[model samples]
Target: MTIHEIDKLTGQFYECICFKPEHYPKYDQLQELFYGDGKLINGNYDQPLEFTVQSYIQAIMHQIDDGNATFYSQQEISDVTEVFGKTAQRISVYEYSFTAENTAPWKRGVNYIQFILVSGEWKIVSMLWNDEKEELAIPEAYLV
Candidate 1:
């Protein structure tokens, strides 16, 4: 019903994935932010990788288990949200790094997230994101 709720949920989305070297990610918290049929997609590569909420958590756990991501941090830099009745969408710009000590983010990306009001609470329906690359830099407008 309010943008503040949306903002808070988005903030939680970022928080649930971040972790320090001595701590594990709070991925379990994600289950509470999404609808039962929610989906997440990573479009960084040629072929988009899609996952259900549970699968997304498993994938991240696997990354940690493989030691590919011991410490990771991701935060939204900017976002634009639009609401219409019970549906809303947010295009968020984010920066992230695999190491917690990095002075600058190693990568930047955009996430297009869709939300719907279910039983008076907003829930994420789907989220799709792509990382910035050499030929595909983030637009200056989004950086602000």
Candidate 2:
């Protein structure tokens, strides 16, 4: 997929499962666009800007436990948005889940999402799923 596609797709994904706390930063950026101050954004997006060595791994553990997720490819680094300004290409492997009768379990083997940088941050713009025959477009109204 093209860089532009990845950006749009990631934006859509953020819009989708946004009720999940970990995804809050994506909307935080959007709020920054609407509000003159970053206070509202900062207050709402509560992930800390830094972490200690052990806390860093702990954070990851906490995230996975809470269903914090990301899409990446085995062949490339997922564009988590580099702190420095630079563009890089990566392969894709998308993973998300569907709610079951009483709970939701992570669904694997969806697609490889391609991402790109816009305004100095990386955003998913496109998805290349292995199951091309059953691809789904996340609805805008579905986002909270």
Candidate 3:
């Protein structure tokens, strides 16, 4: 598939996580689109933890119990590069803004995501990201 197509899928995957407040996470969608064994790293996590998309969405659901549900307003992909081989890799930089009611102001972050083509479709294999911080910020070129 083309980078453009993969970028669209990435954005949709995030939308599934942040925008579907009216229902339980569309975990089945994630299960098919992501590697059954995926890994995620974020600010709260101490290490890159491996998980099935089902478990990952379950974790997100737990956050909702605390009245936290972030919805994204914008999503941008940059620095896309593809390496076609036995396991094709599509890597890119992702940026987005999200906010939840009664939470801090809208926060933005730059992240690195890597996808591999499995069973003829792109599946996120691993990802790690941090909210924009004083020491490390999204580069100006990627701010678009």
Per TM-score, the best of the predicted structures is 1
* lDDT score, candidate 2: 0.35
Say which candidate scores most in lDDT: 1
Query: Which candidate, 1 or 3, would have the higher TM-score against the true structure?
Result: 1
Of 1 and 2, which scores higher on lDDT? 1
lDDT of 3 by residue, 1-144 (tens): 467667777777766665544555455677666675687666534565655566777777777666676454445555555656524443345544444444644456755667777666777777666667667766777644
Error in Å for residue 108 of model 1: 0.8
Q: What is the Å distance of residue 71 in model 2 from its true position?
A: 20
lDDT of 1 by residue, 1-27 (tens): 469999999999999989987988897
- Candidate 3 accuracy as lDDT: 0.61
C-alpha TM-scores of all predictions? 0.93, 0.28, 0.70
User: Lowest summed lDDT over 10 consecutive residues: which window, candidate 1?
Assistant: 98-107
lDDT of 2 by residue, 24-83 (tens): 323333432221211111111235234322343355446656765442111221333222
State the displacement of the C-alpha of residue 114, model 2, in Å, after optimal TM-score superposition. Answer: 2.1
Q: Model 1: what TM-score?
A: 0.93
User: After TM-score superposition, what is the CA distance of residue 100 in candidate 1 from its true location, in Å?
Assistant: 1.7
